[model samples]
Target: MTNFEKLLDEQLSTLCFKPNEIVEAAVVEVDRHKVLVDVGLHTTGELKITEFMVPPSVGDYIQVVVDELDDGEGNLKISHNEVMVKQQLDDVQSLVENKTTVDAKVVEIRKAGLIVNVGYLTGFMPKRQASIEYVEDFTSFLNQVFKVKILSHDQIHENLIVSHKQYLIDEIGGEIARLEAPVEVGGVYEGKVTGIAPFGLFVDIGSHSTVLLHITDINWDLTKAVIEDFKFGDILSLRAKSVVTSDNGSQRICMSLKHMDMSPWEKAKDDFVIGERFKATIYKIEEETGNLIVSINGIPGVVENKDVSWTRMTNSNLNNVFKRGQEIDVVVKGFENKMGFESIVLSHKGCQSNPWESINEKFKVGQVLDTVVTSVSEKMLFVKVEGDVEAIVHVREVDWINPFEAIKSISSGDNVRVKLMEIDSSERKVSASICRTTEDPYKGIVAGTKVLAKVESIRVNSVHLSVLRKGKKLEATLPARYVNTVSRWLPSGEIEVGCELNLEVSMIMSGILYLKPDNSERAQSSFGTGDNPFAEAIKAALKF
Candidate 1:
């Protein structure tokens, strides 16, 4: 070596360069495999082409990090990737301290988090911090850029954690604050349904502010409502019913869809007049209240079970009379509209002609007509007379003898002649008598009149007998005294049903005949004892 060359080498060695030190270097030579850069050291530093993201041309200055002081071939080795990574870490640290955000691209997806590229260094975003909502598919965000805030940083450990949800909240927080002022109670706004739950629906009004629409506030008839009627992503006009502060000190809005529309009963008074009839369709029958929900001109009305029919129904099963989609005429009884609630009261029977209104015209006292027995009770017999009006035949008015026994003889659907004994139009009551159709047999019978009666039944103390007189049967009661008198002549044990006997009518009261045996001694004295003419004449008169 010459003296001047040796002097330049000694001068370059005085630059003071060490390994792992980042310094600015100027590109001196560029080749396909390596880029030679001058770091002002004893020798030029060489960087592999793979290390530089963008190829560096000659005379271009770039940041580089010293990886080794010398290679085995006496060359200085540096890395461009390591230098870029160090610069990015320093920038990210500054951003974290200042609470600033930066754009990051999702490069890879992992089970626990997403691998994102922030400038030169890779960052990690956990699944929970990815977005405000739950992320189902992380691959959808691959290659997508999002502004993120640094949640944590570990430069020594190379742990860079970022949150995309925090960035979204900060970005939209200003708009939400502006909306809170105008969102007062009773205000109306358009919102989109974001989620559906069993209790209610979640809707986003504006600026990503979510509110709840409770199930009760959705409609007036919750019994007939279902959650399936609504769906997610549906746009609905909602009314702000209330504002509540949550435990987290955040404002929550309670909305309503029903309040946005006028109530059905708001104009009910003008539309429904009492006693006026309107055709309506039965829509639903409430099992809880036993009320028939009918729609008249698209307005819902209720017809209680009591108002379903004029006749008292069996078990109040209005479902037997009214059904879904059935069209029937109903009369408006009344309506109420108060405090944002509306209801219309209706009656189905009121629209029909009242059978009691013309009851007197169709039936009169002492009118005898054929009727069909509809139903039988212990003390009364229900019969359907002319005009389909029901008249009750009480047990007392059923027969001249035992009224209860007469009820057993007739059954439902049996034909019988009845006389209308009483009619009350105001009370809507009609009473008939089955025995009054014939003439009274005791009208002309006088005391001491001899008659022959058949023993109907024999009791311990008395005997019940029936006599045929003038084609009418008359029931007579023989008292114990009279029965003993008869027992003297004929053994009481021998008295059987359908046995004939001679008796004289003693007294008649309250439609009952009192009888005694014809054993009067004065009658035997009038005609001498044997084969007495009076006795013969009495027997002849009785046709015994």
Candidate 2:
């Protein structure tokens, strides 16, 4: 304690003070739990930290009501909130009658507004009434004080409605006219950033209302600098692009930061040429497509997913491989000007050496390569060879017969061993065969070899038969026109898969076999209808 406070305490030791008396006190010390104040009595008074609308600091003066001159514990007690309620009830009875204003300290945050302690009552201040400026986070205003006029009151419930915005308007009188200044297109002016949105930034340029500085207009290369580079209250020199006013007296102004200076495209024409290689930075990645917009020498360029790599596009997952501001090599395909020099078409894959140039040396006909299936169709399977070269596996090449059935085992993302059958370097086409990876099942079998076959797949004009030779199944087609078997064994009538058939190898060439239904007497007898006269006599005797 100071010597002056000590002397004052000794002199006031005999002073008389009663409970419920309002007294002005100076804050002596304060902490998180309690506040100590000198009430000009023999002893200092204690007030809870929660009692004050706003926490008071040392040396501040506040009016409080004395609750008890001395408690049994010898500590003087006071109530700041009670004193405020008393003053509020005494002076401000009705807002309609008094037309009065009071200063309140922000004590709590709510969804619609801030909760504060108005003298003699608790009040609410709507968020819009707090300020004309946008408040991104209301929590930042906690514990601040504001002078507000009561808009509505419920004295019985100790509830008061106040507005700080009205207070500001009353204080600023004619200065509000500055917002009505006219804004002309192409005129440069300073703007203050107020809020950030997904599509753009909201800034105030001293017009009737806040304007939008669109994301596209914020930078020459949209991805070069991210939206996070800016913050609220940042001052920017911008040019007014367009202004529009709504029927409801609302105004919207569009501004640009890029137009404040000359575009880089103007100088790119002299420094760069078409069909040349140059280094570029990834500007942005399309969220829906795997397309890239790269910047070269500060000039924008487009790189589609097809030009990104030799691999085919399945999804917009290129963002996982590339990032904004990353440096990459690209080929300047061409430039086009629409209104202005919009962008130059670029190809990142073109900058690399083509793998097809050495196709003959790297692979040969019938060379087996590990392949992954890309997609499956009824008649063909698309696959990637060595994870790069795109190749097709026709169903006919997958198996000698029943090729469609073999296709069901292969699907997208499945690994299969296939041999390259044909490679057309000029067409950039590759034909592969999945069945040829294994040995031919009919290696030693010659033409005219009779074998037992099963109907594998039925067709309109013919039926595919599976012939087993040397414990391996080979495919053979039996033509309906060539079938000369017994009437009961006709393959064209109602042949089903798994039905056994007596077939003769009529011809064999180029790994394909032609079969004719057997017509031999032994073959016919084995499949013909059966009847006996002895069975008929036995049935006649039983009927009598």
Candidate 3:
């Protein structure tokens, strides 16, 4: 190497020197990037233009700190950022000693204090000393412009401490204190999300204090979402739920979005009704019941698996059917308590069952149909037509010459068309009719009636009477007065049968008919006769 170049290599060394180390060099040239200087050491040292307060022109006098050194095999390594930081720290130290304030820029964030640029010098601002009111987002001030109070400085490390909030706190603490003091239960306030933790978030609610936000306080939609969906420095409107004081008298504020607002249960009650259908989203598979906890318009409900096949079928079939943010349809079953919504109960199955199931629509009264004769008795026919249902048609209800003839013609297996006479849902039975499907004939019959009677039985002067037929015996009546007429006459077995007579139906009680004889011709007989036949008949018979 040439002599000048050889000397230049040695001069480039010792760029970093001790404190207060001074060096001189010729300003060979100056540029925006750097200035070439012949420090006249072993060779010459160089300084970047950024290191200088003012850029130097060519051939101008320039002074540079001998901050570091390196052999010319590589360029000298030096930092103007540190040198400028040291000078700024010295300036802030003087201000701290005098208790002065100056505008500054936050340079670095650390656990203990903020390194700030005060008057283009460095300073340290401790967290507590930063403000009387808490500063929620201190990191946002990094490289941000602000006015700061000079707090303290360290000479050895050349650290300068400053606080922007301290100056502002002195100006605004009273107003913020007034605003914070009157907060009551259920009172709401605006806040910003400043910090996030496993338990909750920390929010600044304009109270000069930061309040904790429990995870449960977040909206249901955001609660179930991953924690990463939100970030620090987000602003939110928080509702105050409680304010508790520590044993030391430090007030701890609790906030929520759900408690101060309408609960999901309350909202569901107002928005939905029983049997109403809605769309829903499946939140998760429950660990205990393995049911799907679905959200019906944000209300949660369980879809319990009715069977094992159903549970398994849904697994593969619904692999893509439901997921976070996926929408679905559901019916509101009922209400239940859940999460912060203490009244939020829900159901997805109650809508399936309806009141229409119990009403029988196919059957009605007064209808004729074929029926199976189930039982036969002297007075009635019991039959079943539809399934196991049984109905009875009385023999008196048959339109036949006599019950015997009706029985002979109507066998047990005969398909007889009958009318559904009556139905009682409470009794779960039907009454039918084979003869009186249209109207009941005996319903209009009067109690008093005179008719020709036949002596079907020889019971003294008493005899069974028929309206027209004598031996057919469709219906018969017994005389209430006949007992007296036969009292003194012949014995019941000695009385003649097949005798002609006159009878009146005196009165009918219940289903039994009572009859009285109208003729006095029987007075010659052994039977007595009077206004009642039996009273006089025995006297006349004794005279004969």
- Return the candidate ranking by lDDT, descending: 1, 2, 3
lDDT of 1 by residue, 386-488 (tens): 4435788888788765677778887778999999988887766678999888775666788988878888998887899988886867788788777654643
Clashes of each: 0, 2, 33
lDDT of each: 0.74, 0.73, 0.57
Candidate 3, 303: how far from true, in Å? 7.9
Alpha-carbon TM-score of each model against the true structure: 0.39, 0.41, 0.35
Per-residue lDDT of candidate 2, residues 411-521 (tens digit): 688988899999887777788998788776777667667678887887877788878876677778887786433223542344668778767788875555788866564
Of models 2 and 3, which has the larger lDDT?
2
Q: Whose lDDT is greatest here?
A: 1
Error of 1 at 117 (Å): 67
In angstroms, how far off is 328's CA in candidate 1? 3.9
Model 1 pairs whose backbones collide: none
Q: Output the better candidate (1/3) by TM-score.
A: 1
TM-score of 3: 0.35
Steric clash pairs (candidate 2)? 84-120, 85-120
Instruction: Give per-residue CA lDDT, model 3, range 1-544, as digits (tens).
Output: 9999888777665444654454445677777787777655434556667666556676765455555465556544434445455556556546777657687777788888777766546567787666433456677768876777666666776666666655654343312223636456577787666555665776667676777877656765433634465665566676677777778866777787656556554666787786677766666654555466666655455566431111122242233234555665555555654433343234343434322233246567767777677656566666765543467777866664444457656656567778887766555556787875534434534655655555566444345555553323335656445645443353342335665445556675544446664444433342433555544555555566
